[model samples]
Target: MSKELLMKVLNHEDTNGQLPWIPFAGVHAGKLKGYTGKEILTDSAKLIECLREVYRLYQPDGMPIVFDLQIEAEILGCELLWADYNPPSVVSHLFDKEKGIPCKCKFPTAESGRIPIVLEAMRVMKEEVGDQTALYGLICGPLTLASHLRGSEFFKDVNKNPDYVVQLTSFCAEYAQKMADLYIEAGMDVIAVVDPLVSQISPKSFSKLLHEPFKAVFDYIRMKGVKSSFFVCGNASYQIKVMCETYPDSMAVDENVDMVAAKVITDQYNIALSGNIPLTTTMLFGTQQDNMKGVLDLIDSIDNKKNLIISPGCDMPYDVPPENTVACAMAVHRPDEVRSMIANYSSSGFDDIEITIPDYASRDKVYIELFTLDPEQCAACTYMVKSVTDIYDEIKDMADYVVYKYFIKEDIARTAKMGLKNLPTMCIDGESVYISIIPDSDELITEVTKRYNKKHDK
Candidate 1:
């Protein structure tokens, strides 16, 4: 069946409508408008403007209003280190910093931190696009939100002190219900409960710790007469069958789980299944042709229209090129267009070109190799390159320094030779010390200084 017909069946609408393609645009929307993830989320105007641009480009059937999971934790006093290419990861957990997990967790009001910003954005989006599009209000699920508040301790709490963990998760559930109510009032059509961390726990643990809170949140959303979806990212294959029993209107899984397998499980429960496409590998790193083919492969694999919703496996990378996402959306809406694109598609290195790094040992000066796929297009690569460049500027004159930026696509051999596992890595004198995470500037300086001093001593 066609994507449009499939979407209609999933939405419980007439068969004449087209399939609903919802791309989890998340932090990528921030990059589209030249704002960092933190800036885009914390400011209502920026978030609205960014999402409007996303709507114009993707023409999605449904779109998430706000995708930041840190809103609740930020309001609860957890510190975050914002990224230009990704949603800010929770850096400091409040419960960890405080003496202990509070007996009673207080729910955050709309006036708290970024909550007002998200709500305002939702309201504006509803007024502007509600007629044509289904607006999704994304909230971190109780288990995941509790994890953010208490850190890994929450996981241990589940293993060690089950009763207290249950209380904490219940508190998070109440907060989610309140947030869902607020979003329903703002005209959201769907409330998505995203608890990716649940994948880490065993099914027994999930049942004991999350089942009640999960049911409460979904039940509350249903009571309010709004639709609900549960989104989980990571290796959730083990929990897919059990997750279906939660009775969400829809369940979204990431690339780690097989869609064909998920369809069978979700079908048993008669729940809608969305996703399993590799966002990082196919959408973020792969070409438009790659995305089109990948999505088509997934669509062809699923059996029933009522049991499927085509989408990215998880939230898109912040710097994923807009063209790729637009291509994926178009492919989902118009399979004929996808067929045409695939027929004429050529395997050209348009974006995946590589760069060559000169041998620093052969040269007299110190060498700084900034290995990247494409700093201009890749957010993580851009920051990694910048962090090294900034450090270079601080100590360039002090040493005979040479900085070269290498793109992996153009120089696969160099990348492999360096034994680099992640993109946007830094190499000093052919030794790779920094991996995926951004290294501290002072640390980089110290390492560079040591390298220079060691060379002089030799």
Candidate 2:
């Protein structure tokens, strides 16, 4: 089938358009609006506002009403550690070794933690952009929700007390189905089950512990006559064939799996496949031209658009810029335009610039060195390098350390020799220390001081 026919099937519309476009703009939306993942998720009004901005900017064919996977877990008693730039991490699993497992896990009510926030956001999005965009309602899949509530124990439990694990997953499935029903009633076009943790489990355990529960969830959505999508993140290549066996109308995966292979499996099963983009490198950090080129490459590689959705591999980082996402959306809708833009673009003022740091070893003072890409070009890299510089300046004389910065573009051999993975890394005495994100000032000082003392003592 052509891309148009695939889109028609997705929207249940007349068969006359291209394949559906879905941008998994999770926490990235928060980043665009300068809000933390926790704040954006916990406040319905904020989430709606941010998404409204996204809708206005991207004009996507479909979008998830709430991109968070921890909502259901939060309601089930998991304590979340909220962050300013990223999604809140599940800090405390209620069923950990210290907490002990409960006899029964009950279904959560609508008023439970974060549930009401998500539902309200969905309602607002329905009222606002419901006519044009296919709003998706993302709920934690049974296995993932169980993992958040029980941590790694959920995996161990699958092997030890298989029956109890079945019961727990069954409860989670019902919870997910209930959440799906609520979102569907609120005007969501698709129900997406996000179970990233399942990538870690064996197919045997997944089949035994999760397969039935997943079937139950999908069956409930099928009964409602709504489309259901299964989303997984992480390296799940081994589970791809089995995931197709679950029979979701659509499946979305992250960059860890090969898209071509996933496409083959999904096509064989007649299930739609979406995504496989690198969220961290491509969406969060890459340039607009880079994003366009990457998307076009993927599009050219795929022979079948009959069941495909274009999207980022997983939840976006909170700091991902809005313009990059807009660039992606534009590329998806207008490949010709992207190509033209790339061709016509000229190097900006900061291009091809070389930066260097003066020798610090000859000086009598202790010295701190921060290596980064040009700050004027990369905001994230700039901030990270500045963070290290600021800490060194604050405690310079007292700690006997001088601070210096070196741009990566001018020092490729040095960067490569340090064996760094990402940009804006910190190095103390030629030893690469921190990666992309900046570390706390005091903590960095303490670490540097310890290293300095050890060197002097030796």
Candidate 3:
């Protein structure tokens, strides 16, 4: 709860103890105690009640006081569309030139917006939990705050108005300091700057527009003598190097980025690394055996430097059965028992790597399965599937290959079984051939024919 526990590990000091597990549950906890969305978020008493339940149920060593990223935006004049289960989404951007009312978009103060409500909640929670659990204050990152202020234009401004974007982000950095001050004052031990949008920009653009502003925030937090972490969701594979350079106490990545790659970068910086328990498949939908197997595999993959902390990739999804999280915790506390349960998992996701094809000495057909998030709804998925269909039709009669396309959301077990991570993946003969990129007609034909020709080998 203090610098001696999670903070010591994050600060890279000699803790000589186990690292903590902090799943970003936030509003998701409302599901456990049956509190409506507004009540859970707005009522301090309800917030306290939720905290007790979380500690009792999950026993997370560290937890966030509130994960509502919209507080700053709302204070700046943006409207929010609340959900019953999850935190509200920004319905209006306050600084977009065309859609935003620019005059209303200004920097917020401690007294502005829901800041008072949040500070009060933190104050109450801190008194309630005291030092028994580490408390985190998740301030919206500059890039993500810019997205709330300016909407999608924030992404474009990185290239279109890089200088202006930098200035605006600097303004966000100040707000981050204000929020951190309030949280620290309320007894928060960690200030996590959660900027889930940083991965959306090119690495070069991230350096130009985001790196400095983020450093300014981290530096300010360091001067305050509190622990800090940078949470970037999505495939931040491009921004990983630049992320470490910004000098956070720790860098928390998501499931989209492989822990192996994340470990290499975080180790170089000598910072603690946290994340990415499989949010949907392993934690929400999968069985205890599944969580144990996946969590153990993830735990074994990273270095035993005490830097790796296991947690869900992003905010824990609502409706995620408590049993799954308990299973995750079991993996932490009872590794031997959990490891033994691995043999019981039937729907082993990546065990498909051992997929063996029966001797195809005489078979004349190539079996292909196209995996997508949602081909009908996702534009890229739809296009990728179309490209495959177009080429397959051209050589369907000449080459005996059959394809079946499916949406990942429609089946988690199926998606996991294929060991597919990226969207718009095409698996031919038990191996992913094309991933995230649509293939050229010639290239597609060559690969398909190569497989089909092997079938007819005399």
Q: Identify the leading candidate in terms of TM-score.
A: 3
As for model 3, its CA RMSD to the true structure in angstroms is 8.3
| lDDT of candidate model 2 versus the reference | 0.69
Residue runs of model 2 more than 4 Å from their true location after superposition: 1-17, 98-105, 343-458
- Predict model 3's lDDT versus the native: 0.72
Estimated TM-score for each candidate: 0.74, 0.73, 0.77
Instruction: Encode model 1's per-residue lDDT on 1-458: one tens digit a residue.
Output: 13244335455554432456888888789888898877887788999999999899988878898787777777777887776666776667778534255434456667767778888999999898787878889998998778777765554577677887888788889888878877888889889998776665677888767788898898899889877899986557778776767778899987657778878887888788888666655786678898888877788777565556778876777767899998888778898778877985654433444546566666555677766544443333444555565456687854443333332234544666567754455677777765443464666678777877777774
User: 1 or 2, which is superior by TM-score?
Assistant: 1
| Ranked by TM-score, top first | 3, 1, 2
> Per-residue error at 29 for model 1, in Å?
0.9
In candidate 2, the residue pairs with backbone N, CA or C atoms under 3 Å apart (3 or more residues apart, or in different chains) clash, namely 4-17, 366-401
Model 3 Cα shift for residue 327 (angstroms): 1.5
Local accuracy of candidate 3 as per-residue lDDT tens digits, 1-458: 33246666786766553556786778778878898656778877787788778877887768887877788888887898777766777767777665232332355555777777777778887787756777888999987787778765554566667777887788888878878888888788889999866765577877877889899999999999988999876567778899988899888877778888888888888888889886776777687778778878887786564676777777776667888888887786567787877765666453333333433344567766666543432233444555566566876854443333331234544666566776556777767886654454566777877887777772
Candidate 3: count the clashes.
0
Model 2 lDDT per residue over 217-323, tens place: 98899899888888886556678778877788888887667888888887898888888666655665568777777787777778776677788876665556677
